[model samples]
Target chain A: SAVISQKPSRDICQRGTSLTIQCQVDSQVTMMFWYRQQPGQSLTLIATANQGSEATYESGFVIDKFPISRPNLTFSTLTVSNMSPEDSSIYLCSVDNGAFFGQGTRLTVV
Target chain B: DQQVKQNSPSLSVQEGRISILNCDYTNSMFDYFLWYKKYPAEGPTFLISISSIKDKNEDGRFTVFLNKSAKHLSLHIVPSQPGDSAVYFCAAIGSNYKLTFGKGTLLTVNP
Candidate 1:
């Protein structure tokens, strides 16, 4: 098991602005995934962060909107660009070996 | 296609009673299956899992049963506890490489 930490646990942001969320892991894990969960909804996979390479996004998501960066094995960052109300949701980071989540960053775009 | 599906959105069970959560997948290619539990304001946590080769896996009060032929799986928690009340997620990972998840089933344990 690994201990993952994510910053900006909860934030209220303005529309058209952007906020970058950071994730730090206690141990080096090969896989790091980003997920978004809207209120009363299920979790949707945004992308898979690979160290030193561009993140692999899921079908409905794009890099232009949700830019991701995995600079190293233990750290990654996700920037929600040009936020909107539709973007208001709980953003979580998970690692491999079953789903281990951080506290989660709740973003409320106004 | 909705590869993974948790038909029931919510389930209510009394404390000390048995709680059963069902999950089904449309994709026959799935080789690995797992269950995760989540609480509000927190990320989902790993619970139990059963691989394609195994029909059952158990841990403490939790047990997972897989019926590969029906493309279905279920998580059973004996003697439900207050802490076990949370959103439970069903996930599968086939040779395709990535794990696909179901919407999740909210289990409410009334004390």
Candidate 2:
């Protein structure tokens, strides 16, 4: 098991603005992932944050909209750019050792 | 289309009874499956996992059974306790080491 922490556990953001959520893990993990879960919906993969390289965005997501940064093995950040009401959801970061998730950041667009 | 499905939105069971949560997957490439339990204001916790190579795996009160032919798997918590109540999520591991998670089922264990 891994201990993960996220910044700004819950946030109310104005539309058209961007928000960046940070994820820190207790130990270095090889693979880190980002996921989004809308209200009452299943989790969807956003991207795989790679250390020293570009993140791999999933089918419905693109780097321009959700740019990711992984400076090292233990930390990553996800920025949701130009947000809208439809982007209101819970964004989570996970370390894949098997798999473990961070306490999600709940984002609401107003 | 959803590759992993937990059709039951919620379930209720009495304490000391067995709580069974079911999941089905549409992808045959899934070689590993896992169950996670989540409480409000917290991240999902790892519960149990089963490989497609095996049929059943048990640890203490929690057991996971896999039926590869049916693309189905189930988690069984025997003698369910009130503390065991939470949202259970089922996930399948695909070729890229990516996981596909189900919608999750809220389980309530009543005393």
Candidate 3:
């Protein structure tokens, strides 16, 4: 089991503003995944962040909107750029191939 | 297309009774099935997982049963407690190693 620490447990941002969420893992991992859960929806994969390389985003997401940074195996950050009311959701980071997850960052755009 | 599916949006059960949550998948390439529990304003927590090779996996109060032919799985919790009330998510990992999750089931274990 892996332990992950995510920052900014909850945040309210103005539309068009940006918020960066950080994730720290207890151990080094080759891959870190970012996910989003919108209201009344299932969790959706946003991107896969690997150290020293570009993140691979899923079909419905893009880097310009949700940029990711994996500085090292133990740390990664996700930035929600130019937020909108529709972007209000819970963002989470996970390691150990989805076996463990951080407490998640809840973003509310208004 | 929704690869994974949880038909029941919510379930209500009495405390100390058994709680069963069901899940199904359309993709046969999934290598592992997992269950996660989440509370309001919190991230989903990994509760248990079962490999595709096995039919059953048990850990303390939780048990997961898989049926490969049907592409279905279920999580059983014995002596359900009020504390267990939460949204339960069913997720599957395919060859890509990324998880495809189902729309969670809200379980309410009333006292």
- Sort order, DockQ high to low: 3, 2, 1
lDDT of 1 by residue, A36-82 (tens): 98876777889999898889999999999999999899999999999
Per-residue lDDT of candidate 1, residues B1-111 (tens digit)? 679999999999999999999999998889999899989878888888899999999999999999999999999999899888999999998886677889899999999
For each candidate, the alpha-carbon lDDT, in order, equals: 0.91, 0.93, 0.95
For candidate 2, the clash count comes to: 0
TM-score of chain B of each: 0.98, 0.99, 0.99
User: What tens-digit string does per-residue lDDT give for candidate 2 at B1-111?
Assistant: 999999999999999999999999999999999999999878788899999999999999999999999999999999899999999999999788888899999999999
Tens digit of lDDT per residue, candidate 3, span B23-46?
A: 999999998999999998677899
TM-score of each: 0.94, 0.97, 0.95
Q: In model 3, which residue pairs have backbone atoms overlapping below 3 Å?
A: none
- Local distance difference test, candidate 1: 0.91
Candidate 1 vs 3: which has more DockQ: 3
Each model's DockQ?
A: 0.64, 0.71, 0.76
| Model 2 misplaced regions, further than 4 Å | none
Give the DockQ-based CAPRI class for model 3: medium
* Residue pairs that clash (backbone atoms under 3 angstroms), model 1: none
Q: What is the lDDT of residue B106 in candidate 3?
A: 100
